[model samples]
Target chain A: MTESTLETSGRDGLDEQAGGQRNSAAPPRSSRGHRFTSYDVEAFEVPGGREEDWRFTPMKRLRGLHDGSASATGSLRVEVDGSSAAKVETVGRDDERLGTGGAPADRVAAQSWNSFTEATVVTIPKETRAADPVTVTVHGPGRDSTAYGHLQVRAEPMSEATVVLDYRGSGVIGDNVEMIAEESARLSVITIHDFEGDATQVSSEHAHLGKDAVFRHFAVTLGGDLVRVNTKVTFADRGGDAEILGVYFTDGGQHQEHRLLMDHAQPNCRSNVTYKGALQGDSARSVWIGDVLIQAAAEGTDTFELNRNLVLTEGARADSVPNLEIETGEIAGAGHASAIGRFDDEQLFYLQARGIPYDQARRLVVRGFFGEILQKITIDEVRERLEAAIDEELAAVGV
Target chain B: MATLEIKDLHAEVETEEGSKEILTGVNLTVSSGETHAFMGPNGSGKSTLAYAIAGHPKYNVTSGSVLLDGEEVLEMSVDERARAGLFLAMQYPVEVPGVSMSNFLRSAATATRGEAPQIRHWVKEVKQAMGNLEIDESFSERSVNEGFSGGEKKRHEILQLDLLDPKFAILDETDSGLDVDALRVVSDGINRYRESGDKGVLLITHYTRILKHIKPDYVHVFVGGQVVESGGPELADELEESGYVRFANKKEATVQS
Candidate 1:
């Protein structure tokens, strides 16, 4: 089940990378390191918006991250609060546990990997369940420059813990996040991107799961001029489970894109992805791409992914794509669905017929759309804050 | 004491062939404490008249007026019409995902009553109405009309009618898809609303089975978008035995001539 054997068996070793412009005329490049092991910044060339993995992304808005011209000039304050059962350390790039989760798959991630001065590593002790969640706050000082950040979180065997990454303030940032869940461990990560109006961010997150590990990742993207998040998951052993959930709202002149890849490399693993978004105003755009790959040896794989988008006004666009690639037909089950649509006219009419005004009816529908996903968040405080944020977004749109 | 008066009602709907008239100068009047049955065959514009009275945008009132207690209903928007004391039990209830039935009902009550109801009383009222309609308690938590059966939807309509307590209610084809048991439950709910002695019921249906439970004070034989015959309760029995064949033949003759 190694990468070489899988490639030499006549199957292409190159995984399908979204947003990259295809250059079919060029000769096929040799297989890079294993799918999740390549980390050299020089390995990936600067993208010109033509690569399949960068096509939907506004390259110019990236602030030179793709071209390696964006340097770490502004500083971001990082603070972590962990309990007695957890250990925290700031290690250099040569730390042994630096790249256990995965490597950078694209240029921006590779740039982030090479530019970070120090990496924050948080680990939970074996068989120890933490009562309090580990909170990591990354605050920008509203500087007009670029910066890089790297954070690694590891849940030891038979341990259970929750981690929250809170990002706020202004400036341009490129961040890399790695998470590893050991055997029989349960880990949950909540990432909140609450940037300022002029801020831009390009983040890549990688997660690896061990035997019978459970991993849940929740993302809330509300503010930013341009935000792109690429998250990938790989199974290190069998019986692992992953659930990826996201909720986003985009207003005028905002561009938000989320791309996810679930690689089931081991047997009897399962993954589920559900992401919902709402967009309003002119030039408000959102994109979601969900990709699941089940290798030949990954038998008994059960996976399903769904994405739904609601357009609240004119001049807003939402693009949703769900892709599934299976190398073996003996797997248990696999399915994907995506829908991008405006408000339902009949639903509006029905509500109005019941004596509810137009504005109230619209607000109710929008709240209900986001509430379905927000209710799945296990933390009560975080769920309430996200709901309040959604209300604010609705009010901003004059709904 | 309320009255719904329809005078020279002429309405049309937009079709592919352009504006096609549905109701041609129809006149009707129903005062408080009266139940009027509009009996007609399929495609006879019975439902169109009901929808027109409810101010559905699809139905255009070319010339005529609907007056609720001397207030012109045609000049008001759909929601305004509801707040002004008009209710329509749609033939096909729409499903609104993720909006719970309790929330929708409370919102509707607030809009119509000019303020939010007391929670304790509202809960008790809902429980009583649901019990009378034989609806399961779990339905309160479910989305409005989402995954509801035909009988369940009809019962929910009656439940709204009982709670909203509008001056006049236009039940369009409310008995179309109900079984015997469900028909009894729905009819009983309507009768309870009528027992208030100040509510008017405009019952529109194709069959006479529902009439066996809820008696109509007047029966009107509707055809060619107008009421051609009017009589007492015996009219329903006659139409049930002979059907609308005579009215359809007469309309066809008049059109040909």
Candidate 2:
């Protein structure tokens, strides 16, 4: 399909990772408040930035998603590929399976739930394989308008499939995404947000995994003025494994944040969360918050989360917070790492000394910085698109 | 023949207490086809002179001037100095993550040569240089200096000196960490560079071990941040037997006087 005709959501993309962090302290991702959830928008109050969950976020940039003044003036256009690969349905709000993946955990999420007119649900049935990745393209209303959207994807028992949720175009938006993997199912979901420059999007995504299920989610954020994403994963039974991977690049005067939660509620469950981000230009900021909670009943749970940020220029900033709470001491490995590093000066000097100009040298180092994450995305088209986006970002700054 | 000249150069480094002087009022000149070995003790500021000339950001030049064939050397940025045909083989080459050696070397070659080298020829050139330095072919695919042993990093430095082919090269304790076998391999690489008879070499070392292989024409005794004496190659033999004690005491006596 051509880039212009496909409809996609303005799911403004943002993603996050960490490495070699505090060895002594337990994850200090302090629990300022419980992750409250509800379908009612009024259940949550406007966040004041002092809330632990909202501290690193700039409330003023949320553009009324926090205050209730922003209402959807336009609708999101979502297009699901042909029916040959999987089952696709455009269901209204009253569908029984609509909110089964998760409930709205924040004001923007609850607001999106209350406002979106309809939701799109896709399912890969039992013992079937999705030969080609099911592509769901979502296009925004326009940069001048505001919109809300919802999407849910399901992987049935004994099935295997890959879903690509491509969010494109522009608008000020809020949305909710739900994902579920049934018993013995393997599901891979890759979400790409390549929005227009002026777009602002706030999204909440949740994943539920069943017994012996494997669910992997990859989030790629290359554009957007302000994109804040809250992603959570929960296990419904033992032997459930989930891997959350994300990569994001923030340009000048942009703000990107990723808040992730891994809840090991079932015994013998395993989860790994890794997110990496790069920020360049003046006032470019990236924030990552990782929280791992191990309940008392959960035993033999293996979990590790890492968030790493690379600040590529003088005026850019990165904030990483890793919080780990364990209610039971008898469990498998559990740890979290968070690190924010400046571009290595010596690395630049070493390359520059070899006669590479300042701009070219910076590009080389930045490419190498993201190489680790890009290689993990085995999808050819997706990886190429990511590389092109990064190159464009580098050239835009003449670096 | 191009001449690398230092006239009354003075530089300092920032320490915890305050700014502390390192190189104090030093002057020397090196021409293509001549190897000048700077023999000194630990902390005698030998490496500082190399870094100051290479335009490392950490060293501040308080006074004096460095000239590359009558042009201002101190005014150029690090990369510009490199393009101007000056190279510094660092004692501690830093590890740059993610960038493979092949990519880095090609980019550097492109910058110095003012165009990307023809890929077909560039590949052969790199392969030949790697073989000459005894660097395994795998290293070219690995990140620059990452996880390299001391001996391997030294050999890698020499490999660049062979490939970049600068007009004037600064050897900043490149011989410090190598084993005897690796030292011979590195020295052989340096000797091959000088065979062209159009490159000036400033070989900095504390011991005379490397001098035996590279064979410097001029030897300078560096003590207390200054070159107190310069003589023929025989000075290296004398320093090797007697060490830097006499030169150091002479500077202390002069300070007291």
Candidate 3:
């Protein structure tokens, strides 16, 4: 019998002590100058693509979002339509909700934060439940121009609301989205990136959940020449729950990257992240990085993040990295899983054995891969549209 | 009467070392409404024959002719062979994550039947098939064999067999890993397919347990890469009473001499 060299690590809990005591020794908030998380774009140096977070991303395709070379030449047309029960206002940067969640960690996000002259704030009043979703559309006029945008969504105490941010058209864009779910409130945010020809978009989204609040964020990237979305979730108090789900498809010569961070800072908070993607055609690429940090104070924190990527054709690459940082052993649970591979031959054979053609079977498998995450989107129309977009992607691959 | 003829069948499989020949000069014939049980010990090329007939890419036919109803079976792709009225109840069914059993069954049915079945009728047929195999209706919504137990996988295989209703069926160790109850259920499903009266069955097994429930019209005892002996149902009884000890000893003696 030969020894198997396959290294398998799934469902294995990391040794709590091995995670280090930095959480206990270091002050929660630094007394010195502004401390830089990756989101503190101004406090950190501009990325040259060699940074750990930016290494997997194609810097050339970013169209100057990495540095300060790209400026706002043209603007993104922003439209906020809310139900009669909700309130929508185009507030200035001085609005209270502007930086309530967190600071922009990357250069493009900070640039977007500084460049946007006006910020759109969509508010769901305390104790008021909205039946229809608040739709925010950011359309880019097809041009070789750069623009900046910021949108703040606040669901007050005990309010229930769903927000859909639909992005389409062309041009370069840098944007920041801030969502605050107050105590006992429920908020579901769906961000869809459906860009046309030669579009480049970099966006950062930060969501802060209050006590007992539930936050669900879905990021669906279907069409784009280059797109990178960084979504960060933090707990404001105990019992806060967050679920981050994403689905992306990268076609030939397209680059789609999704970076997510789940910060469990309060006790009794829970978070779950599941992001799935598929890539096809030569030069098609995708990157998914899921980072979960359970701070020392986050006792009773339950968290698990999973990312799975399916590479369909030759020259298509998928990079998946799942990182978990635990500062205490008193936590309830914390683990992560990431898998990047081509289609399972066994699965293909099984489907083919049932008399389904090879191409149809592949399509079904890819559809199934995205369906698990896409179904988590509560909005019916948006879910159906994403499904159709996936079909179109599959057709483009000639599957 | 549709017939499957395997004449001078030879096949090799790609291994880590190199391409190793498995089925050497195998010959068999089966017509509709007949069952041929191929019994052999481990590594006697029993499953290889089934895979070769099913046109698995892993198994290469060096020199052979697999004819289904007077057409070239080996030349067809895996799905084409399946669509050409061939069914294989694998020992270890692959688990396809994400694709639900209902969708998989409907796709298979459509591919084999050459058209999509009506949604209402398809749902009813799937429900009835699941019920017959003692499977819960919820199983149809679960991904194909993703988290299924051994018995559940076997039952799913039988479920496919019943729904597809192919002209020729290959049962590859379909009795393995099944408990007595599951064995009975699975055997009953196979028997039901056989009773359809216009299908041929190739029952491959290492044990005679399944033969008791679904009797084979003929039993071929395989040794090495070829059939060493062929007889009626009593051959299984004889083999069960003694074993493949004599055949193993004969092969060893021949190798030594």
Candidate 4:
């Protein structure tokens, strides 16, 4: 395997941790006034496109979308317990230093990731298990602006909590989240990205799983101009398990993409990933890329990934790519399957023959597609939110 | 006035090996207020006959006709056929997840009635029908056929029969997987569906246990994909007593012709 590397932009003066070869223009001196020290930034620096794992994603899309690159800090807020938890925070003191904050107003004018707001980090106390789900709401500032926020999570050993993040309002936004699952800890995360028709969204997730830990991630992308989720999970010890699930619906010029990577680095680890989405209207596109890897050192690993997409309309399109990489001579079980097909005409006809209208029959088909993901949610409130998100997406598409 | 008539019915299905024949030159008729039984072993074209009548695309009618109350239903789509008063209780009811039984029934009734029924009235009727089948009230809230046992699936099929209220229905071996208690519940549901006197039924099965409850007026022996013998209900008794070997031999001779 090729060595992973991370680079920093010298002129930008943003905190960057380089993994392999340092860039020639790299800045050595660090600032003390900032909450994040050089060591903190280094720990957060993700492997860029130089690594094989990040090759599928077009780096050009992230060229300017980093946390501190945007000019405007658009109106973004997270509400918990009937009050705003925090305002949208950025990495720079002025707009000139952060470039155009998030996305520009016009589609033609927006270039690369410059439309994203700065990354806002939200920290949850270790071992603090809350009774209610935390709600993070993102409201757009409208016009030409993009917002990016990274809610850093660390659930201490034996702690359990559920986080609900809602992306409402208008405009363009780019968000990313990095979650750390401590030893024997559990975390349930629900994220609903409901962008308006004209807005664009690009988000990423990097999670680390400790020994004997459990992590459940459910992402629902119901609305967006361009939505892409890049998520990666690595099991650090045996007996760790992760469930990565999502439900997405798009129609008419909307682009939704989910790229998932699950690395089983320890023996006796388990990972299950299932994502289902539906596409409607001409020119609508949905993409799913599932990469499951079992290293040679990790014997006795059981991993399975399935991505199924339903094309509700003739002109709508969906692409599913399921990749499996096994580097061991050991006979461990690992498999992947991907299917992209139109609605089952037989099923639709069967429902219709029972006196269901054509339109209602279509709804049932879509419902079945998303039901696979919705059934995994254990909390009632989260499930209801997912249902409402789906309903709103369907209504927006005139279904 | 609700009557089902199959006139010299012939149907063929296209397989990869080319077109094959399933239903070959069969004829039958069932008027309103009558129950007919079609008994045959597996692959005897019983289910094919039912699917052909319901307008399944796989079944091609080469040179026969199906008429319901003098209206030719062979040209209609499956949904159109259902709206025109023809229903088929599948041998294996499909499991459709995320679609509640109540929602499916209401939507089906709306399509057939040309207008959505009042929610209260529809719920009352569905509840009453489900009650007659020994189904709990919670059954309506579940996804259609999903996680339902074989017996529960069969009962749900009967619930559709009662709720859709089709003029003529083809019950395709609905009693095959039911126990004694479930068999009684299913038969009772079917009986209630026909109490209005405007419904006709063609119950197909391999066993005669279902006949004990539905009490068929006529029984036909299906062998070699054709009805080899037709008689009163006593024919079912004869088959139950002697088995289908004799009928199979007779069908082989007919094929040699």
Clashes of 3: 5
lDDT per residue for candidate 1 within A22-107, as digits (tens), equals: 22222233211123334666667788998667877888888898898898997677999866677988988899888778777788
**Any runs in candidate 3 off by more than 4 Å, and if so which?**
A1-42, A94-96, B118-124, B248-257
Across A295-358, the per-residue lDDT of candidate 2 in tens digits comes to: 6667999988887777777788777777776767778888777777777888888888888888
The most accurate candidate by lDDT is 1
lDDT per prediction? 0.86, 0.85, 0.84, 0.71
- Cα displacement (angstroms), candidate 2, residue A72, comes to 2.0
Encode model 4's per-residue lDDT on A144-221: one tens digit a residue: 565555455556677776667777777655654667677887877777878777666667566778888898988888
Residue-level lDDT for A334 in candidate 1: 87
Candidate 3 per-residue lDDT over residues A1-399, each given as its tens digit: 111111223222342332111112322231111114433345557788886668878888888876888878888888877677779889887877687876776678878888887888899999999999999999975668888888889999999999999999999999989999999999999998999859999998989999999999888888789999988887889999998888888888899989888877789999999988888887887888777777777899999988888887777877777777666678888887887777777788878888999889888988888877777787789988888888777876684
lDDT of 3 at B235: 95
Residue lDDT tens for model 3, B75-188: 888899999999999989998888888889999999999999999998898888889899999898999899999999999999999999999999999999989999999999
- Residue B128 of model 2, lDDT score: 97
lDDT per residue as tens, model 4, B67-174: 898889898878889998888998888777677877788888889888898988887888888888889999878888889999998988888888888999899999
The runs of at least 3 residues in candidate 1 whose Cα sits more than 4 Å from the true structure, single-residue gaps closed, are: A1-37, A82-85, A141-143, B10-12, B15-19, B60-63, B249-257
Model 3: residue B34 alpha-carbon error in angstroms: 1.1
Query: For candidate 3, what is the DockQ-based docking class?
Result: medium
Score chain A of each prediction against the true chain A by TM-score and list the results.
Answer: 0.90, 0.89, 0.89, 0.74
